[model samples]
Target: MSSTPTTFDVRADFPILSQTVHGTPLVYLDSGATSQKPQVVLDAEVDFLTRANSAVHRGAHTLAGEATELFEDARATVSGFLGARPEQLVWTSGATFALNLVAYAIGNATAGRGPSRFALAPGDEIVVTETEHHANLIPWQELAARTGAVLRSIPVRDDGTLDTDAAASLIGERTRVVAFTHVSNVLGIVNPVAELVALARTAGALTVLDACQSAPHLPFDFDALGVDLAAFSGHKMLGPYGVGGLLGRSDVLDDLPPFLTGGSMVTTVTLDEAHFLAAPQKFEAGTQPVSQAIGLAAAARYLEGLGMDAVHDRERTLERRMMAGLREIEGVRILGDASGVERVGIASFDVEGVHAHDVGQFLDDRGVAVRVGHHCAKPLHARFGLTASVRASTSVFTTDDEIDVFLDALAGVRPFFGVGA
Candidate 1:
């Protein structure tokens, strides 16, 4: 380890990884879906539930006040993660819910129900990239269909990259909203966010970023990144499964109507007229994820203590090694190389003569875990002429020894299937 204490010891934390998988030592590489919970994050959640369990934001009791303070402090912690104002963050169930909130709210605005600022109409176009996860794609497709607007996509190149020149041309005056992924879940391709944001700004479109992949392992600044809104999941960042966030500029968030509303969002209510509270509270209507939010806050602090840059550096090194090793396999083809662009530690590939499920099982039998499927990017798979692929993703705690075990397991995969030289 270097003099800097950024080193991650695999056996030190993560109780789950300490056990054997199928009677073999475990090798976990599926961080693209969700990361393993560290002891600190687990301890935080347990502490909150055991001691400070109560409803937040609408109570006067001691436990209530403590819960409220921790919940808001969690909001502040996540806000600091993205370099946004704490009040600018909205708590949702997860990344999917966060994406749906924006989609539904934008759909409401298009139907003349939300604030007038988001009034997308007929003949308007919404642009998305072919590489986007369904979380970022299908919602806009539904919005475009509902509004009678055109749904356009920036086509991915042969190497699974968006043709930015094509994106500049396709995002015309009629483009009302442009949504894209900051990093691809399947391909490990980090899109050109600043360039795309500039183009969207030029086209007078609202830009929504799906930062579900980038937020966990990279340094993020929603404002400096020039995104109107960005969404991420707590589970992917080493927290529990059911907490997520949507970070937006305060003014833009203020414009959107609440998607899930019941009790706590209202300021005043009448038979036919209702007024909602301000940005964060308005969007977070019901009893929020009190324990999960606090868990995610601790996860955020855990990552912060590790430092985002160090995390990025460690993951980048692992990704390069993983990519190089995977490519050396004769029948394996990686999805996107990105042509030297910076990316995180997610990588997807396909074996020429093996089904992705079989590949996944083969790897699993040897104690290596990976994700295998379209990865919720069906259109992206079609773009690459693939039905499914095997994805291996890593995080800060992933060690080179684990990768070596993974590579050794993967080397035998083709021979077992009779598909290799």
Candidate 2:
């Protein structure tokens, strides 16, 4: 409560917060799923559709030219936002697609194209974390399945932080690739990427980072963190859906082969063979999500204007407030380190007597929207002896009042269900 941010009333910017969900004003606590769009972002999309709508990097028409310029500008915006050069960023459908591209691209390299830097032999290892969202886990699983490689994971402690001791023992000479989330989507635990990356580097392995949760909540410098490649989605950061970024080291990308091939990504295409475009252009494949990219860039600009530090500060305040509120409730056991350094506001808790789904229903009836169930990290839930938990996440646009509404509704859920006092 002491750290609650009062300088800015972020609730004013999201118009939808004014409406009723089930007889009460909507208290959206689901930014971890997809953040609510601000007026600036909405207008960016509208303006693109209204004033400048056309294919990019292909058409010579005025609209096409304008759209292309805006789209690339967005690319530049996102690239700069991530502390990467413009050429380092490749647009994708979402973070999942971005991640899938990496796994598949490296698989192609192993098959023979360029240096074959990622060939997964029978004994090679692909390392991941137990808390990874399926997006980061399944691609590697499929890659390992395709190759004869074995998939290994770093264990999570009871507090939800990565088990560095286990990581040191697991990452060995045969470990060819290391991939983990910068921040866990379900637990809100921020992985110690710097320490982990150092471990990966020492093992001479390639590193991939899932920054889906980190990018929106805090500023990130991929280079400083020493990750070989990273991915993040726009929807989680108040940008249009279907727009995400994959950032990889320029040299590393040059070695990995393309996953998807078609128009616009080629330098030359013959009837029997084709030469590829440079790094990012080579990866962009088809006509890109032009408008979505433009909106996403606008979102980047908006976040930058507000200052990433400010955004981080606000979110930290909210996290503490939320943690304090959850701790005050009876029968609510929070599932994370709670050490403050390795955590954020995306909190999940198990109610002693009520089922997670039932709790969700009760919250919904009272107009408090919270995510319930496994939350796409089934393995992490399994590790914690849980099938599901109630999750409430916050964003910069979330206000203290909305959280209060959610807590008030949450407190009433058990009594309404007749499960607990």
Clash count for each candidate, listed in order shown: 0, 0
- Please report the candidate that would top lDDT against the real structure: 1
lDDT tens readout by residue for model 1, 1-421: 2344355764567888887789998899998988999898899889999999998876799999999999899999989988898988999988888888998998887677788778888898999999888888888888888888899999988887789999989998999889999999988888999999999999889899999999998898887998999999999999898999999988899889888777889899999988899988888888899899999999898888888888888888888788889888788889986668788999999888999999999999888999999999998898788999999999888998888899888888889988855
- Model 1: how large is the Cα RMSD against the reference? 1.7
Show pairs that collide, candidate 1. none
* Model 1 whole-model lDDT (C-alpha atoms): 0.88
Task: Give the clash total for candidate 2.
Answer: 0
List clashing residue pairs in candidate 2.
none
Model 2: ten consecutive residues of lowest lDDT:
1-10
Q: What is the C-alpha RMSD of each candidate to the true structure, in Å?
A: 1.7, 1.6
